[model samples]
Target: MACRRLGGVPWLFLILAWLPALCAAQTRAPYIPASPDVVLQQVPPTTDPRVRRFEQLRLDLQRHPHDAKRAVTLAQAYVDYARSTGDARFLGRAMAVIDPWMRRPLPPIPVALVHATVQQSRHFFKASRQELTTILAREPNNAQAWLTLATVAMVQGDMDEANRACVKLANTGGDFMGMICTASLRMLTGRAPQAYALLGLVEDPGPKAPPEIRAWIEGLMADTAMRLDRAALAEQHFKQALQWTPGDNFLLADYADFLLDEQRPRDVLALLQGDSASDTSFLRQVYAETALGLPQAKADAAAMAARFAAMDARGSHVFQREQAGFALHVQHDAPRALALAQQNWTVQRAPQDVRIYLEAALAADQPAAAQPALDFVQRTHLSDPSIDRLVARLRSDAMAQAAPRAKP
Candidate 1:
């Protein structure tokens, strides 16, 4: 299960990678086998086989420091562990272990594929593309490699490559979850209709699809629907997905997004009650933002503040969530909130965080704080209508307010 989570954590497929020289670097270092320390989480219950394999690899590597075979095997196990658990640090460790051997003389093709999965997590599109190219050159019929290439190509905004890869993989057999992947990608790229059509072919209504495949398809479908301005569809699909996979932290987060968008901030708070404190920054933001409309919002801020503080103190979570909080609370002597939010943003560049900080600065009357975010949004060219409309309204209203207080 850890391996499966690692295999599928959002955006993780973009980061880590393997190469031949990286392995060489490890080989020369104090005779130390690349046993990169793998941090793990026990939650969500990883499958026992994945856990057993991860432990076996760790022990094997402990014994044979120089055996590339064992090290590569161990790294793949770690990838599996990380995927199953949805924790990234294990994959990071896996990369450190495999780095010395990437590219200068690529690891075995399968091992290289594992390496590519890590790279994909980091959004290193170019490297990911290279990984697929190399793998396909060696074995064009490798379905997983092709699907991955398609996925990464979509990440890099290379829709044509993605389409080609998907077209090729569509014919390949096995529980290929290509529809989910392709449809979601298409939806994000502003082809919601195509996404929906592709989604129609997914095995969601069937009794035979495995839970993992079902969850993947359902989550993507819900998200695509939400982004395409189909909030009701999003809500329905999200609830259905949840029914199929209860206690999914990711699904809860999506629900929060939907609630906030629909102006039901209190619902967001209630829905996220069971989520881990660190995981609810965005939802917490919905609370903070919606608080202005509530008579007793300040009362809730304390708990939210505590949650942020605990997360800040915990130090394992990323910077984006923290940045969002700062953008929310900095207006009223909330320096700690601002700092924490900024801290998280600095550690990682999340577009959502950028949006929050932009809005926060605007609300706080800190134009300087907003400039960079403004630039980032413009550069990224995200045409989020709600945000654009809000910004436009703010400007228009500001201009109107400034025009005449003359008679009064």
Candidate 2:
């Protein structure tokens, strides 16, 4: 699904109907910039069609030794895969691939790009800044680098920086990067029209775009549609994305959540593989565990536990996912879940995570938990039948509790 050249990597984005591009609201702490500029050189191979392909590049690296350029290419591929896939491990793998020669320099354009991406992925704002600036210092027109810089800025909640960087990159290509970034700022900043306009660039999925690229677009389209309150369209795009990337864990999780919202848990069990090892698979683990009467409940729970526990929540997607899991499993605290949902409800997961958590909290008789979520829904001006239903339930429950009763 991705084309990662020998030096530069590709990001893998799933079909978009899942949630906010920001993924999750991180709680740990601020992302620290790399203390020092980590310069990497050693260009990867510029030839070989197989080397140019992601699968081939990965295999080529595994088949050989310190091929710096190929390593970078392979690493970048992983980064791109991680980005589009919404999987942090792929990013970790990208970092791991470059860990050995990170002390050295001179890989290739693509390889260096991958490193810059890694910094961005880690939310190592400082490092991302340094690497990006340095890269642009050399290749000023490297639109991808500019996009990476902008994404890092966006994650930091630096709207100005994100705008500036995204604007610069916006014209770099008529491709997905420019359109997606421009639309991203628009959506997050409450410019649905602007965002939708940008999305319109990719009116239909391209046949030539690789699988990963296709998946990313699908996910993006779904996200935009959901924001516009197009549930059927969102589900449609999600299904398409899932079809394209069957092995994609992120897509699976998103789909599972969608299923949950649709009250179709019976389907979740078939898609998600439940096992102790599935722990690192965050969203999928959640899907497998939540679907009651799952064929292999115990195994699914174990997998969910292992995967969830092993996850590194630095990435926004992973962090938010883990938070949701905590609300679902550890806390069973609908209030906490509702809090987490509303925290990001404005961003994405519109009627799903936000509403589901709020509803669950109310259904669980946690009126306090439902309060903040209600305020959030009204403030955002989000009007959905589901939200209305849940709101009514919460209000009714609160009223019942408040009513005076005859002495029993």
Candidate 3:
């Protein structure tokens, strides 16, 4: 029995592609392949049947570069591949496949949609929204466009816009997809307990359901559980999701975060040690390594610095959140971290973004700087123990700073 959470539209392909872009340089040493089938790169080896099919698609597209249908198909495959493995590098491949269409003033609906998906994957929210808007203006009933638009809005902290898009999605797609979409927004807006109950009643999708969709539902449940402070339940949900798609980068990073929060740094290391190609996983490994006082943390931090430098050269601001964390924890630069966090807040207002902003403000002794985040918390009624504790600390610090000091 398929659970009526988010029906149809094959959202599995687009969901994780919405994760923050965190590609990093590969640091593994080069090795010669001893066997013809040996794979030197990629999360799953090319020997996997799926990868073989993808390669064949790529070859076909290469032979017919001007084939719009073939280009869209392959680009969609690349997006799915990136979501499955948490590898943003595949996004570039997707872009290359769609580049021919994008150069034109107005590409076809399918090309524009895929292009917008890739843009979102790279954190180009404004560009993505513009593309989605163009598509919707032409075809208002485009369920995928509405869903993608809603996501871009949510990421940017525009709850009103997101809700509007969700309503449209429900009307166009189905109640289930709308419910799942709205439930996610509610999870972030202080109604997590309710969202958890609503989703729990949803029966798991049957064997016919796509694995990515199964993973997405389980991951959403896990995240909602975490917001409600149900750590044990959250862990179970995370594990279940991983069973469906173990190599999902966003899932691994999120689980690593849970482990870190529980003070199980060793477990985080065990989970993310071999996944440094993704900056998200790489940063988590640094956090775990630092917690355990491992010698390798220093070298990893240096590598992260180099990666950030490269990102800066490219003028990319997508990883500002991760960069802020590294600056604070790994580089021990509180002021720099605070600046990055503040700048990042201007782009993303997710709970994690707000928490980092609060943390950076506190570390920099700039309680005044945290007012925006504090206001956001109060306004949204966001539920998270960690965020609440940070709020309390900031309030306490502000009071201490304001109290009259006795004359010495």
All-Cα superposition RMSD per candidate: 9.5, 11.9, 7.6
Show where candidate 1 strays beyond 4 Å. Answer: 1-86, 96-104, 123-126, 171-178, 203-206, 265-270, 274-408
What's the lDDT for residue 148 in model 2?
80
Q: In candidate 3, which residue ranges exceed 4 Å CA deviation?
A: 1-44, 62-65, 404-408
Instruction: Report the C-alpha lDDT of model 1 over 1-408, residue by residue, as the tens digit.
Output: 001112333224232232344566787754444565753443423465666677777788879876778877888766655554345567777876665555345467776787787766544456667877999999888898988888766544455677788777876633345666667557645567788778867745488776656766777777667656788887888877777765555566667666766878767666665343333434454463455456445544555556556544533343345435534543354444445445544433343555455555555555454555455545544334455654564456556655867775
lDDT for each residue of candidate 3 in 1-408, tens digit (9 for 90 to 100)? 000001122233234333333232244445568898985675657787767878899899889978999988988988887876667667767877777676677788998898888778777788788879999999999999999999888888888899999999999998777887888889888899878876765537667888888888898899899888899999999999999988788889889989999999999988876677887888889889888999998898788899888777656677898889889988889999999999988878888898889989999999988999998889877778899899999999999999999899
TM-score of each: 0.59, 0.62, 0.87
Model 2, poorest ten-residue lDDT window? 1-10
Best by TM-score: 3
Q: Model 1 scores what on Cα lDDT?
A: 0.59
Q: State the number of backbone clashes in model 1.
A: 52
Best by lDDT: 3
Error (Å) of candidate 3 at residue 280 is 1.5
Worst 10 residues of 3 by lDDT: 1-10
Candidate with more favorable, higher lDDT: 2 or 3: 3
Error of 2 at 265 (Å): 1.3
The model with the greater lDDT, 1 or 3, is: 3
Query: lDDT for every model?
Result: 0.59, 0.61, 0.82
lDDT of 2: 0.61
